[model samples]
Target chain A: MKVKPLADRVLIEPNPAEEKTAGGLFIPDTAKEKPLAGKVIAVGPGTSDVKMEVKVGDQVLYGKYAGTEITIDGKDLLIMKQGDILAII
Target chain B: MKVKPLADRVLIEPNPAEEKTAGGLFIPDTAKEKPLAGKVIAVGPGTSDVKMEVKVGDQVLYGKYAGTEITIDGKDLLIMKQGDILAII
Candidate 1:
């Protein structure tokens, strides 16, 4: 199943948190911070007042705890309003 | 010190979390959810590529973990990009 956002909202697929730094020390899951970057999967048409700024396939950075989590076709995804996004990376 | 956001960014002053609910029960700080609503204190001159949507004085909702926290002149504030805002409430 596919997810679609509504009115200034977006659907994103989160990137996994890095388990190792450039120095190559492994980090465990408990020590891992929530990921803040993702790939845009879908975008809303935006309300009459707000215009959509992101498009599908855009790599975005979002708030660490943003969005409602959902499971679609056994895949974890996030549905959030555009405002939860910080920047296109 | 006064804060001025840059390039599609915004400055927000968060509303305090509600300590009492409509039923008059008190909520402890440990149980309180992070405030997601705020009053826009300032706005950035958006980059040429992106137009600004929010203005100063607008009430907005943002992601709970959005923005960088900073203190200016003893006041706590959040500096974030326009995309971190979820809606104008």
Candidate 2:
């Protein structure tokens, strides 16, 4: 079955972490948590106080530990609030 | 100068911690951090994506370490997003 995120949450498929990359990538360090890059797999219907900014197939940046990890269809993924996303790349 | 919270932020004047009391108080322990009670002193205009839910003079509950501590006009206060608030008391 396909997983669907609830209000203000988004389902993301993280890109494999690059090993010592050096160019064309913007890595922002906001706190102790590391930054990660990913692709949006699904998005929730945002609440009245929030709006969904990222759509499916959008490349995004988020905190490494920003979302909850879940397994769907034998694939690992993350479900987080839209606020957890740092930016759409 | 009086402080004004920006975006979805709210300014709160916290209630003093009770000296180990036990009635009419709903204490929610979501994590290691303790819950706190406070009065909403000011609220932001809210972003286009977020609508302000709490209003000035509203008594609210929130996590203890949820916001930044600031000293204004010789008085200490907290500034945090409306999302940090758990409920209105």
Give the number of the best model, judged by TM-score: 1
What are the candidates' individual DockQ scores? Answer: 0.04, 0.03
TM-score of 1: 0.48
Give the clash count for model 1: 3
- As a whole number from 0 to 100, the lDDT of residue B51 in candidate 2 is 87
TM-score to native of every candidate shown: 0.48, 0.46
Residue-level error in angstroms, candidate 2, position B27: 44
Candidate 2, residue A16: lDDT: 71
Error of 1 at A73 (Å): 0.5
| Model 1 DockQ (Cα-based) | 0.04
For model 2, the superposed segments whose C-alpha errors exceed 4 Å read A19-32, B1-46, B49-89
Task: Give each model's whole-structure lDDT.
Answer: 0.71, 0.72
The share of true interface contacts that also appear in candidate 1 amounts to 0.00
Kindly report which residue pairs in candidate 2 clash with one another: none
lDDT of 2: 0.72
